[model samples]
Target: MSSSTKPRRGLSALAALAGIIAAGVVLGIAELAGAFFRASATPVIALGSTFIDFTPPWMKDFAIETFGTNDKLALLVGMGITIALLAAVLGIVAFRRWVLGVAGVLLMGAIILASVLTRAGSSLPDALPTIVGTAAGLLALRVLIARLRRTAVGDPAGASTATTAMTAATGGRGATGVTVTEKDDAATGQDGNEREGATAASLPSAGTSRRGFFAAVGVTAVVAAVAAGGGRLLAGARNNIAAVRDSLAFPAPASPAPALPAGVHPPVPGLTPFVTPNDDFYRIDTALSVPQLTADDWVLRVHGMVEEEFELSFRDLLDADLIERHVTLTCVSNPVGGYLAGNAKWLGYPLREVLARARPLDGADMVLSTSSDGFSASTPLPVLQDERDAMLAVAMNGEPLPVEHGFPVRMVVPGLYGYVSATKWVVDLEVTRFADRTAYWTDRGWAEKGPIKTMARVEVPQSFASLEAGTVMIGGTAWSQHRGITKVEVSVDNGDWEEVTLAAEASVDTWRQWSHELSLESGLHTVRSRATDAVDGLQTEERADTVPDGASGWQSVQFTVK
Candidate 1:
């Protein structure tokens, strides 16, 4: 705090900064290495349907169309490179410098906090081990510095070398009786007669410098440990979430796929489309990989704007009445018409049941649903209450929800497009009005209430299609999502609509896939599909893209009658 002390303090600060930079660079390298390991694994193509079953249909569509299950490999590799570059920059900036070093450490910590450090649910508790390790390093550094200062710079024997030389030089009345040469005397050494060390002894400044260096390093370690520890704890505490992920293993052959009504052919060959095999569903989301969380650790908080704050446990939801309903989910990002939607049986407690415990006030219009991983969707409470089967589903197709699918619990609303309905890995349900909040997607320029638009696809080749004049099955899927797909019509290019045989309607929640047999003549042909919903809304033929709202139009497929 004094004038003379300013230089030393500045130097110490510089040394401290260098230490932090060094530590952060080391940590960055470790994280980048982890990224490399992830990149080397085989890309997960279909995360299995169970993992994707409950994801907001819109989110699922986006991942497939944008990242594509396999292209995700590139993103992992790119993030690794970025992290490594950041580390290199930090290392350079920290080269015996303080401000730069501290800055680098802070940057590295932020990257880790926002991305890498949050690998699994409840990241806060698991980060304790890191705190313990960094703390131990600082403690050791401090104690080592104190001991080194005393032994290396403060040793008396080490400091006495100059005193002996001085006594022999000024021998005018020396106790040992050694005569001093006129040319060598400390008293008159100014003109080559006296030596500076002989009279005014001094220790090597190098030793002092080394001692200070160590002391600064020790201080740096202590500060870094505190900073990192505090950050980890704060972040972990703020985002504490756990979702149980059950395994959806391949089914035994005997459990033949669910029987479909007379006409529909499943999307995949050889199996019925209604019963999505657990192993064959699509998975896409921000989580490049799934985090496996345990049931005992899972907690669902229902605490905002509620008369009674209900903290629901996995056991509580599962113990209530179990309902099984089949539903189709679609992603908003699916192309003007895309393949990112699917149908599957989901099992769980009705969402209305959970909200009941919270006892929402009369004004509560929206339930802002959130995940353990910082994603949210504002589902209108009115929708859930009106649809009795809408649930916080835990099981998909008769098995515990798979980890990739939000695992322990997820929201399931029929009729609504995924944008406002399906929220996977759900952790919170803030009972509030629409005016009170905006969800993650809403902030990103999407319509607040993204209802699924009517859509239909053509499956088989008909007349003029170069098919051998024989019976051919023409089938495809149509979805109004929550609104119930009613009539599906197939037509030959610009031909009249012919009613196709429809699959049994599982419920308003499930998609109604339909099929019809067509007799074709040998030639090139164009087939198209269109759907009429229960609300009398017809699938539009206009070309409108997915923007602030969902996509719509007829689905056309070209083929030849061989």
Candidate 2:
């Protein structure tokens, strides 16, 4: 009710609000950091998906209804809830008298505990980060509450500030006032009253406290709002950072398709001069959505069971003494003749460079690569350490990694399937044991160790009933991972094999992008291609589904040529 106290309370509230905002920023940074680390351990390609597997045909259609694959919409789907939870904790803590601050802290702790309880599961790796972050948030509340209490007790008005004017007016106040000397009290009271009135004059003049409660409330509200906004923005920034770094790693291809000399043609009719482009690279992940993240926000943390805990910034990675290598990558999910494999120039610091710096103990057999959206792949450390071009590659063809690919950084292990080797949009590389680790796909019933199955595809038409009498062109692609594709043959239905021309081989780690051209007449045709490796391993005819290991048998295409 006193005029003097209103302005002081207003100013104090503003100060408290500022503190709350700072705290919220810290909370956002923490979540972002966790997301960054979490990503390195897994591929966070999808979030809030109700059905990961066991889907019927209609189920995919229905699930798509809920979690549309348009990444931008998916990224912010649960942001409202995230902001609300963060706000409730911050708002309550920031706008408080001492007791209120304590209550706010307790509230924050309760929220954290509830989140942990709801997230219990080895399957849910994020549960750990969420719990740790929530606990830190609550602890921050406790510190803030204690500070508020101290400030309250230290104030000249003490417990009575809430109703100090009533106490002072009715002459019913106690030692909280300290009753200096009656004469001094009279003079001080007058002085306090005068200052209170002046403060009130500048304030809204509707407040009733000599302390800073009203100002604190206002400031805290503003800070809480600001913090909530920040959390949403930083939540997935690590992936975005990967996108930027990826953009740098693989750039747009230059040098259009080379003009073939007269009568000289590409063995595969559709083959381009250069192999894979970053945008067109095949992507397979559990993340229903590609998280939107940025480069400035990306950070890498290497901790736990390590002699030294290392955290890296984007610049730190770029500035590190670098090594560049070209390696071809393959996917286990690729069918016997699928397009899921490609080879390109890769540039980055070598895995040996980063690992030697970390100095892993003897028992570490796997390096778990995690993504921003919570997807993970367990990779063999020995493979990376051994005679392979394994790299923490930042660049793909010649530019940054593409967002569709692992933008910032991903693992490129030759001769292994992506499930066991390639990890994209990777944020963390935890050195651990296979017995102790399970990746996103592993939990989903995928193979524990995915090896590339040797196979080849027919690129040219061999036997056809639908081809025109005139000559038509036919061609396709083949791969054998690190072993390399050495020889290929195209055969018509029950026809003799014809040798196909191959491209200049780069390395065993790179795919030998090859093709065979054939002239065909209009007819329905059955075409088949078989590849032989450098070790003389022949392409098998045994058919297999993509399960415990890669697929088998030669690739065939049946079509009409006119």
Highest TM-score model number: 1
Q: Write the per-residue lDDT of candidate 1 for residues 1-562, one digit (tens) a residue.
A: 5543553343334434444444542432332222222211111211221233334545544545676555356554654455446544443333323245445555544433333233323344333333343334334333333333332223233222222222322334222355545555446546421332332233345456556656655665555455545544553444333222332332332222344455444443322366566666665455555543456657888877778987888877656676667777876666654666778887777887777778888888888988776668888888877754788887778777777787778887877766677888788888898898998767766788877778886544432344565776777677786678889888876699898877767665567777777877766777788898888578888876666677766777777876
Full-model lDDT, candidate 2: 0.56
Distance from true location, Cα of 326 in model 2, Å: 3.6
User: How do the predictions measure up, each by TM-score?
Assistant: 0.62, 0.56
What lDDT tens digits, residue by residue, belong to model 2 across residues 422-503? Answer: 7776778898888988886677666777757667765344333255555555655566777888888878665898887776
Error of 2 at 531 (Å): 0.9
Q: Which segments of candidate 1 are over 4 A away from where they belong?
A: 1-63, 80-272, 460-471
Residue 299 deviation, candidate 1, in Å? Answer: 1.7
